[model samples]
Target: MSKTALIFWGGWEGHTPARSANIVKEMLAGHGFDITLEQGTSVLTGSDISQFDLIVPMVTMSTIEKPELENLVAAVRGGTGLAGFHGTMGDSFRNETEYQFMVGGQWVSHPGNIIDYRIDIAKPDDPIVAGIGGFAYRSEQYYMHVDPSNEVLATTTFSGEHFETIAGVVMPVVWKRRYGKGRVFYSALGHTADEFDVPQMKTIFERGALWASR
Candidate 1:
């Protein structure tokens, strides 16, 4: 049976959630997933979220109703997968501690906003990053508060050019973890849909989504 995915996109327009949703929808569909694309977090309320194999939240810096947030958490705890990229996953629901805990990270800042940086594959043997070497890209280098339990797959060193205090700090750029019985994956890339045009970034997102799905 083909897997199902629900993609909720909307919140901060600066993130271009709509375009990102479309890109993800196409990618997931190509992988044989039945997609349900919706805007806003209302769709999560009282939904039988466990039925879907994967959930992708393209929302950024938004608030979700308590009951809806509870439902989404329950679903993941019950084995439904959750996967997303950039602030869509990491920087969302800023006020919700449980939500942040489930995601395993929260974006704190992006120093130097859209500057050139290098992403190093921390685990080259991992299938999600296999054959991909440390590559350079120009974008926001996300500084995040991450859970130590996260299995970090990739990282980037802070150049200290933007924020002198955090200079040389190695921050996680890609990671995967388990929230209860569900799998969770996140990448601090994809500030825009066009970022997906990069072969390595695209492949990482694609493979990470597949890996997170049930």
Candidate 2:
């Protein structure tokens, strides 16, 4: 049977959640996934969470109710997979510690806004990044507070041109981890759907989704 995936897209308009969701939906569908797209977090409060093999939250900086957040967390912990990119996952739910814990990271800042940077494949043996060498791209270099337990796959060094204090710090750009029995994947790329136009970014993001799905 084909794997099932649910994507919730909405919250901060600056992230262009709808456009990003469409891109994700198309890519996953091409990978033979059965995709369901929703507009808000209300779906998280419902009982249908168990039916999905994977969940993608394209929401940014949104508040989720306690019950809704609990249900979503339970679903993932019970073996449903979760995966997302950029602010949608890494920068979301500023006030929810549990949510941030499950995600394995939270975006603290993006120094220099959109700027040129290199992403190094830290774990070249990992399938999510295997065969792909470090590459340069122009986008937000996300400075995140990450869980040490995360199996980091890629990283980028801070140039300190924007924030002098964090200069030379190697930060995780892509990582995967387990929340209970479920797989979780996150990438700091994808500030816009257009970023995926880069072949390497597109490949890593798509593979990350597939790897995270149950």
Candidate 3:
């Protein structure tokens, strides 16, 4: 059976929510997904969202109503898969810590803003990042506060060039975790939709989302 995915995108235009959602839609469509792309968070204010096999929130740093958040939390906890990349998921819902709890991390800063860095596969045996070696990347090197329970798939070391105190710090770039019976996946890469052009980045993103599908 074809999997269904709901992508509700709207927030800061700087992050290119619409473009990212389009990219995701095309990618998943190629994989035989029936996708519904909505424009805002209003989609969640309704009844149940547990009908979709996956939920991808392309929104970044936006406010979600209490009841809306409650419904989303309940749906994910009830076995709906959740997946996203960079600020869309990690840095999204700035005031909603409960949403951050479900996402497993929150972006506090980018440290250097945008610079060249390398991402190392932390778990080479994990299918999400398997066979993919470390690769150089250019974008925001996210310094997030992450949950230790996450099954880290990739990591990147901070050079301390931007933030001295965090120098030599090892941060998770990709990870997967469980919320009740549902699977959640996140990646710190993809600062922009164009970042998906990188083979390694695209591969890991696609794999992680597929793995997160219920």
Q: Which of the two, 1 or 3, has more TM-score? A: 1
Compute each candidate's TM-score over C-alphas.
Answer: 0.99, 0.98, 0.98
Best by TM-score: 1
Which 10 consecutive residues of model 2 have the lowest summed lDDT?
Answer: 42-51
lDDT measured at residue 132 in model 1 versus the true structure, 0 to 100: 94
Clashing residue pairs, candidate 3?
none
Question: Considering lDDT, which of the candidate structures 1 and 2 is the better prediction for this target?
Answer: 1
lDDT of each: 0.94, 0.93, 0.92
What's model 3's overall lDDT? 0.92
Candidate 1 clash figure, as a count: 0
Per-candidate clash tally: 0, 0, 0
How big is the positional error of residue 170 in model 2, measured in Å on the Cα after superposition? Answer: 0.4
- Stretches of candidate 1 off by over 4 Å are none
- For candidate 1, lDDT tens digit of each residue in 1-214? 8999999998888889999999999999999999999998888984688899999999998999999899999999999999999999988899999999999999999989999999999999999999999999888999999999999999999989999999999999999999999999999999988899999999999999999998
The digit string of per-residue lDDT tens for model 3 on 156-198 reads 9999998889889999999999999899999999888999899
